[model samples]
Target: MNDRVNEWTPRTRAVAAGRPSGPGEPLNVPIVPASTFVAGGDFAYAREEGTRTWVALEEAIGALEGGSAITFASGMGAVAAVLDLLPAGAGVAVPTFSYSGTRGLLDHAAKQGRLKVRRIDPSDREGWAAAAGELDLLWLESPTNPTLELIDIASLTGGKARVVVDNTFATPLGQQPLALGADIVVHSATKLIGGHSDLLLGLAVATDETLVAGLRAARTRLGATPGALEAWLALRGLRTLPVRLAEQSRTAALLADRLAGHPAVRRVSYPGQGTMIAFELADADTAEGFCASLSLVVHATSLGGVESLVERRARWAGDAHVPPGLIRFSVGLEDPEDLWRDLNQALG
Candidate 1:
């Protein structure tokens, strides 16, 4: 359907919202992998062109977000599109512990003098409010990457600046930032939205049509667009997101609770919510050794998949601001007992 959608429960929306009319359709959105397309239809060209797979996923996600949604080549591409809206001198306040690509983009903006970017601990509501003047936007990454920090979004935003939550971790299934009073919601569809790490994609949703138009304009011009095949994969992922997330969340919490009291670990940070969790070792040497000891869980950086994964956040300078011994864990759909057994021995 070409018309926009409003909320139904997210679980309901994930399956129905984006499907297009077809000649005795196959029931699932078709993954069109074309860089070129014929004019005279809604999608003229693949560049300015649109894809059914992308639209289906966008509509489903947008419906849950209660806004217009757009696709990007990757999560950062989605970030770049929204950040592109800031004109010269417009300020952006982001948490210090954020995804590296986001920090890098803000740095580029600062260097170009196109935007003003500042970092604050997300829980500092008073600090964020005080810093809001002339700040065109605020970025929220709750239960932030690797650190498991929380940002009460409703508390951080002021009318003076727009708030955009990076809902990659919580996903729409776990939290609805817009419903919590955010102006915009962003996701690296590459992560939780896709559920499996098979494809790269990004999504942005905003209640404001004008803002969405501007984001689309940026995406269209920069050619940072998602492919139909990838969009379809994301849609396939969405169909099972609720079930996957619930299992992952349960396993993650089980592991987090177990790790916290273990003698080898010094600290744990789970945000006491959905799947992602972090813990700090006594030192980077211990942290690296623990990762090396793992047998079942892959020692890797990315999160949100069917298999458990672990990464040392401090390996990247962007997360350099975090504790040097911190380990970020992305819970998978494995049997909780298997993950618990593997992780406990790994930590030892």
Candidate 2:
């Protein structure tokens, strides 16, 4: 696997996309831990732009997303950069079932008269399509967080608004929103791109270089630059993303089928071919017990790690739209049988 992966398959690209092609360069990207470069030229300060490590990651993600990429300190930072693209009082539409962090930020901004926000239901494809023309921007999260309801990227992108799809859950391998006519694609690289819970990172990719520049400038002004170490680590994780997602998706599909048939599960919301799964129990108490009973799967809030995680969505004060008994399961790289054994015993 080498740096030249443009003509290669996604699997090959995942492992080979951003490697340095110099005669004596290392196979993996090395961390450029400089906060300030030697002055007298551009890249004088890390806060103003970012280091080589960050660029390496951005390039890798850009290749996958079919555009240029920008990295931020965290997922919220990237979200803020995108929102900052809109002028004050501009109109934007977002999914009601999307990530709570982004939703909460939008809600706060709307109340403060920063932006006008309309909540769209991901399952309501027709409504989304109709509202798209009236919006200045359309923010989408297909297979919306918590509940796995998908949205039609192509139909919504055909409208007047500049479409920005949150491609965190689907990742670049699963879906290329940019290719589908979306203006920008964003990811919580802390999740799938990192493929581990070790770092906090976020990314935004766009076919239009101007839009990417705006995000870059916003990140610079906000001082939302990611650390070199985290950037390097994320690049390391990106190499194995294809393989990791394949295995996790496989196990999740298996678990989703079994859980859907179980009497204890009221509903199984799995759109298919992704690691994330959301299912419902009878009530909040039952859901809490289910989480507690799991011995192998950790009871955690974050997802896309090497280990499995399950938590009740309604426990978070922000995501009330999610059912009280709904548990967001993040399937990890574990044996399906072992995970089922833990889940089955926990169900009882």
Candidate 3:
């Protein structure tokens, strides 16, 4: 263990951070799927959790965020844990447009008279700072869900309230919200981390000991622990994250750039760091037809997979931030040439 798990490059840390003490002896950390443990007990029970399934995810993501990490049943589970930080009837400030689940959960809590929720202009630094005084928690997203609006995390975290980032879209690779001073980073492993979309999972990483303890307590009390199999799949997905990210991001950048120049496209919206991209067509009708025309790219809502996907994000709810014609793209390891060709024909 190094004093600075925090000091390594993203590539180095993503692949190498969670080696078993006997590294090289066992290639990957074995999935310890059990409800019980021996008295030698580094870990007591699977429900209570252990180091193997998540220690790797935690250290790897924590090292990247310069914090400690916790694994959860879904990204919203991690969000629920962080939301536990606020007392009953406390105020929370979040973006006008974010993942539907986050907004939906807050709305659900608000309906239940648990918290006061407000949607702020996500890119407005002063708006965040102004609202921070009244807030118990501040939520942020960079290159936001479908619109890809950029927010300076350093600016967002500056105000009084604790800051929580939905880093699922950006992944831990492209964005370091914790390093920029956010209190916690939450991700839905159903996307980029699981790569194949075969598993449902969530994670939280934080430098604050209080938030870490609170997350553990919430997951424990709420019974949101993931099964051993999903954790194992997420672990496997992570090993190739650096490789997957590099290739997919490279392809996405190219695809977005080419699409931007097309007469049918009104705009392109990927920040060029991760595989997620969103573009809008000149007409909403054409955007629908274009998606229908794609052969190589599947028309799917979820992103971050080994195969490319495109979806009409505006068709989904809470699309206030995204343009009505916006089409989200999730780049995969597919051939860049074929992807471009598919886009060309689809747009035509």
Order of models, best lDDT first: 2, 1, 3
Winning model by lDDT: 2
What's the ranking of the predictions by TM-score, best on top?
Answer: 2, 1, 3
TM-score for every candidate vs. truth?
A: 0.95, 0.97, 0.94
Per-residue lDDT of 113-230 in model 1, one digit per residue for the tens? Answer: 9888888886677878876665789888997776778887877565788888999999888888888888878898888778888999999898878888898899998789987788
Q: How many clashes does each candidate structure show, in the order listed?
A: 1, 0, 0
Give candidate 3's whole-model lDDT.
0.82
Pairwise lDDT winner, candidates 1 and 3: 1
After aligning candidate 2 to the native by TM-score, how far in Å is the CA of 330 from where it should be? Answer: 0.2
Cα TM-score of candidate 3: 0.94
Better of 1 and 2 by TM-score: 2
lDDT of 2 by residue, 122-223 (tens): 878777877888889999988899798989888888778999999999999999999999999989989988998999999999988789889999999888
